[model samples]
Target: MIDGVRAILIGDATLTGLVSTKIYPVSAPQKINPPLIVLIRKDADPNKCKTESGGVGRLDEIDFTVLIMSLSYGECETISERIRFLLDGFQGISNSKDLDIEYETEFDSYSEQAKLYVKNATYTAWYKT
Candidate 1:
């Protein structure tokens, strides 16, 4: 799921124009520059819905978060918007599976320790196994 989401983000021209290939899973390496994206998978569980035969379905829902970090607030916002446009309400086949991604919520803040602006957004994605 993270791989598919990363592909969508890294494959975008507008997003790459802003941050290049600085998308990382979980955490960025130390000494890395700002204007990067971090992807975190919060949880992934089966939908728990019953099929017509009273069997569990093969659908999974993933809770994911994307964090955009930049040295400037405007840059962070630009990157966040680009990502939002790419992933929000996105439905397509990725990694040989049908996937649907939806934006949930977003929050913005400043990290005084890193002196960077941050925008964090949560998303829900459903896919068939």
Candidate 2:
């Protein structure tokens, strides 16, 4: 599912203008440029599914945490906004599978160690398995 999220974010011109294919899964490389996007898979569980056959279909509910990190707080905010606009309430085909994504929660923090302002956004995505 992280691949799907990366596809959506990187596919957007607005977001690419800001990050320029800097989206990474889990974490970015050391000393890389700032104002990048990182995707983290939090967890996944089976959700009750239904089909016309009156049988339970394979449906999975996954939680993903997206981190917008940048040396400048303003840049972080800009990237965060673009990501939110693209991902919130998004339902479509991604990675050759149908997906339903929704924004769940977010928070702002400063990582003094990395010296980057971070905007953490979490989303719930449901898809057939």
Candidate 3:
């Protein structure tokens, strides 16, 4: 079974002592996926979604109640704030519920359930449902 989460990378001196180094889901490195958002405004069907036409893409919306499971147990509110802080670090995050965490570990608790978004070589977060 997979363990909980710990902090990933610690921030710089300016950010040190402000965030934890406890990476959740085993406190190891994690690989990130791709970033893309698709909306079904005109002709959308979940049964026939495809990647070529942007039907299938990274997750852009968060229910705010889903399993954003953290390995280390911080207060939900605190973690939420930390995650919110990461959005800008991920790049191109504008009023979006998107954020991606990147590491280099092969095994992950959220494997196949998350993707990393990048713009101009910057990190962005979007997960899969």
TM-score of each: 0.90, 0.93, 0.24
Tens digits of per-residue lDDT, candidate 1, 31-115, equal 9988899999999988766777998877899999999999999998888888889999899987666789999999999999999
* Model 2: per-residue Cα lDDT over 1-129, one tens digit each: 789889998899999999999999998998888888899999999878787799988789999999999999999988988898999988998877678999999999999998989999999999777
Q: lDDT per model, in order?
A: 0.90, 0.90, 0.28
- Give the runs in model 3 whose Cα sits over 4 Å from its true position: 1-16, 26-48, 53-80, 88-129
TM-score: which candidate is best?
A: 2
Give a tens-digit lDDT track for model 3, residues 87-125. Answer: 333433233322343321111133334332111111223
Q: With candidate 3 superimposed using the best TM-score fit, by how many Å does residue 20's alpha carbon deviate from the native? A: 3.4
lDDT of 2 at 34: 85
Displacement of residue 27 (Cα, Å) in model 1 is: 1.1
TM-score of predicted structure 2:
0.93
Angstrom error of the Cα, residue 3, model 1: value is: 0.3
Estimate the Cα RMSD of every predicted model relative to the unseen true structure. Answer: 2.2, 1.3, 14.9
- Model 2: per-residue Cα lDDT at residue 67: 93
On TM-score, the stronger of 1 and 2 is 2
Where's the lowest-lDDT run of ten residues in candidate 2? 90-99
Question: Which has the better lDDT: candidate 1, or candidate 3?
Answer: 1
